[model samples]
Target: GGILDVLDCTFEGNSTNLGRAIYNEQGATVNVLDCSFDSHHSSNNKKGAAIRNHGNMTIKNSTFSGNQGARSGGAIYSEGGAMAIELSSFSGNQALFGGAIYATVSPSTMTIEATTFVGNTAAQHGGAITQLFSNLEVSGSTFKRNIAQAEYGGAIGVFDSELVVSDNVFVANKDKTGA
Candidate 1:
């Protein structure tokens, strides 16, 4: 509803719709600082199994592990506007599409800094992050051991989108088409 800040919160083993741990709507400004989301699930919808954003979101020093999405964004999903993630980790998450993170619907801003994405999987595209009509800026991150079962982008995908990637490491990512 207004500017929000979450610090040192943990979300694990939850099952629900939208975001398993969080869902933001109506252009709220939110910050998740030093939070953890692990083993969450989305029982319904194609949104975040761990977190969802519909406004300005900033995530720093977080972790997401072993989450599941019924359709999309096993770890995180962002729509509407700008989302900034720094020093985060996304590991062992799964989804039908965009196993780790998904940004879609419109031209949103995504900034990832000093993050890690490891051992995530997607049935279709973007084992780490999927961007549809969005802009992404990633720096000082690592993507390792992620897999894409079909389609492209073991670490990320930009569909009708722009990307600014710098100082990021992509290692041990697997795809059927070899990334």
Candidate 2:
């Protein structure tokens, strides 16, 4: 119904069943800028330690670190709708899948630019990002020292998704297969 804007905020050590710090339900639009989410946690089997977006969302100039999701998306998750993130940093986050971001929306788009993901860990796939059944565009990003303990894609994983990647760098990312 309306747009919510959050700026220059800090969310630290928050814990919840889902979306420990921020949750945007359907039909809501949110914009976050110059914020930090640190040491947030979601309960067991939950998703999104810092942000869970089922609506339209945009985040810029943000930082997420030491966040944990028991299931997926240690920092951010998008089940539907569109999301855009720019100039963000994700570090030391952990989850079962998608240590940094999980996007699983059909007929929706997610765009990320000029971001950095480092030292994130996932028990399964995508130590940094996972995109499933969605449209994803990533550019001018860097991923380093991320680890996927089980499956493929230590830096990123895509399944039944459309992905466009450009001007990105991946270094020292490790998985069961290799770095």
Residue-wise C-alpha lDDT for candidate 1, range 66-144, written one tens digit per residue: 9998888898888867899998899999997788998987668899999999999999999888899888999999999
How far does residue 133 in candidate 1 sit from its true spot (Å)?
A: 0.4
What lDDT score goes with residue 91 in model 1?
A: 91
Error of 2 at 175 (Å): 1.5
Q: Which candidate ranks first by lDDT, i.e. highest? A: 2
**What are the lDDT scores of the predictions, listed in order?**
0.87, 0.93
* Best candidate, TM-score: 2
TM-score list, all predictions: 0.95, 0.97
The clash count of every prediction, one per candidate, is 0, 0
Candidate 2 lDDT score relative to the true structure: 0.93
lDDT of 2 by residue, 71-111 (tens): 98999989988999999999999999999999997977899
Looking at model 2, the pairs that clash are none
